[model samples]
Target: MTMYSTDTPVNGQDQEVPPFGTAPIPGSRGEEKRAHLQARRTEDRADRREAAEERRRDREHKRRMKTEAKNAKVGLALQKKAERQKLRAKRRKERAGRLVELREKLSHHMPLWGLPVVLVSLAVGASGQADAALAAGMGWASGGVPILTEGMTLTLAGLTAQAIEQRRPHGWLMRATWATATGAAAINAAGHYIAGVEDGADKALYRAVLYAGASMLGLVLWWIVMRSKRAAISGRSAEETTRWKRLARRHPVLVRRARRVVDNTGLSLPEAYAMVWQRANGAAPGEPSIREIRASRRAAFKRTQAEAWDGRTRFSRTAPAPAVVVPAAVEPEPETVPELASEAAPELIPAPYLPVALAVPGLDGQWIAHRVPVHPLPAWRPCQEPGSETATTRFPQGQEPLPDPSPDASEDEDGTQPDEAQEQVREQVADDRLDKARALVEQAALEGRNLRRHPSNRQMARHLGCRPGTAREYLTQVLAERGIRR
Candidate 1:
């Protein structure tokens, strides 16, 4: 059969014609091209499949890592929760142990635990008997007898105990408790006596005594317990108690004074006693008394005065004598001079002799006082003409006049006068005071004290030798400069 020719140009290359239904020759260009194309396609397909598998693997790995991280976080949270729970459990266990220890300590006091049982039994028996006795006379309406007698006693005793525990004064409550207990004992005895009166006198007496003893026994036991509790709570040593007792016996007056002090000041017995003893004994050894301090201040004042007197004496002895200025003889001009009238004649009024105490230095460096004339006003002088040469104008008899002071002597190089210099000195003093205040503030801060408080301000005033208000002002300025608030 005749077959069609399969000749075509593949990729712009000439290829040999092959008959239909026949395979191309091996190693031919067409065959090689097709083979190469198929191989490349397969390789590309394999590469795509490998890439897709790698992507899937990467996604799975990321998901696994995220899940592991989540699990680790949850585990850490659980661990922290467990640690917290464990810590809480440890605290609770420690608290329980402390409570157990406290309970054991409290249980060691046997009277504290046994007294209640004995008291309860006695109260129950006494109350029953009292109730029956009261009912015999007042019927069921007297059922409250037990409550009034036993209940009241127990209530007062409990209140006394509470007061003692709280460290409050309960003398009245204690007295009331004792009084109620006595009344209950008496009631119990009377009830028993009346009930046994039909039996015999002796038996009635015995019964009364027995019942009264029962009623009183509980109170005695309770009293012992209360005393024990009080002694334990007081925490006073036996030596201290003995010392206090000895002090009371030896010096009852002082003890009484101490007691009053304690009541007034709320101080403890030892502190009050010490205060009383110190006051009674005056100042302690090595400490100066008020009289001694006053004597010392007087001695210091005397020494200061003596030193000043000595300095003045030395200055007077060593100072140069004043120069006497003799007036030059000037010829008077022939001019008409007005003569004084008879009424205007100069009258020499004798200077009043005023007695003044003069401190004279003695040979032994002691001051001796002498009365001398030191008048306030000088002798009257007649008026003289201008340019007159008179001996009285130049020199006075038995008196040396003070020389005139030059105006320029008191001025500084900068022409600052005494007033301005004094002002500058005052400013410098203020600046020094400010510096001292700042130093004091720093010292107070180092010592952990705040000068803003009133007490601290008083202390600062004492240290600075100033008033508290002035010290407060200084502290305010210092704190303000440091940017500190009040």
Candidate 2:
């Protein structure tokens, strides 16, 4: 059943060709069907490849869109963070600026040393005392002395500073200082007593501190008294006058009426009178009575100000130009210069050049006389020669000039001699200086550091800026007054 194979070998290759005829053979038909199936498989594979490519493209598009969305979200988050950072930085800058402004405002009112001292004092009072007490294993009662001492010292310092700055006496401050010091001293003594008699260096050190504190307290007292004395000496009349002037400016009508009553009516009135008078008077005593003038002036000023602020005008005029009025020249009255009439002086001296002889102290108990022209009456008496009572008199015995005998003769007789008058003035000044010097010594003593080893006459004189003799005399006087031994 070999049959002739439908294939033949040509050029070493086997070829299968369909048999050509009106009817197709089964093998040929089978071959055709297999070819068609292979072609359909190829088309199916192409379609599948195209569909897979389309799916890949859609997935790539989805991934790209997701990536873009992620990038946009990240960028948006970064922008928000940047904005937040910028806002924070702005707030920080504003806070820093406000802090700087606050510091400047504080610096204006407080002195350079004041704020630091106050902070230190507060810290010490709040923490230091408690810590020290705890470390020492002392109870609150036992620690009271140290607390009071430190607190009172700080308070006194502040009070002293305020008093000096204000140049006035503060009675409450003095009273408080006294109370604190006394209480602290008592507490310290009691604590020491309760602790039993300590021996050795510890005891000595404690005693030394106690003494130092006592000395400081004494000095504080002296300073307070001195400041009070100085304030009293300065007088309150000037302050009263200044206050009156201030009130006059604020309420002219009230002040004017008050001044008239107090000055002319010989009435002893209180400040309430002025307050009542002010309540009664609405405007100044001599100002314009009508309201129309004031309203027009105020409206015009506001309009001009508004225009200037709006940049419509370069300049603003609040007040009208004053009218220039030429005042008539007044003929001055004839002034006659009076001549000094004295029997001792033959020559008539002009009022400006009336020479008065002043005797000044010279070396070796001698007097130096100088002729000074008198302008007006001097407040202080003329200087005199030293030590020889009437050795260098201003006027010769018989050549005494009578100052206007036409006036009261008894008054001239009551007038003191130039030397006596000068002595009185010197004495008064010395007294004041002595009081100030005592105050300074008290201050130095309170500092806990001795200003001078011994408060000698020379040291006292140096501190007082006075002569040694004067210092000695002042000390003697003070001692005598206080009933103290020499």
Top-TM-score structure, candidate number: 1
Residue range 85-148, candidate 1, lDDT tens digits: 9999999999999998877644443344665766665664566466456847877766677767
For candidate 2, lDDT tens digit of each residue in 332-430? Answer: 989999986788868855544223344533322245554433233324335853443333323322344323222223432657654555455556665
- Native RMSD of candidate 1 (Å): 29.4
Instruction: Tell me each candidate's RMSD, in Å, in order.
Output: 29.4, 30.1
Model 1: CA > 4 A from native: 1-121, 124-136, 249-257, 275-486
Worst 10 residues of 1 by lDDT: 388-397
lDDT of each: 0.68, 0.55
For candidate 1, the clash count comes to: 0
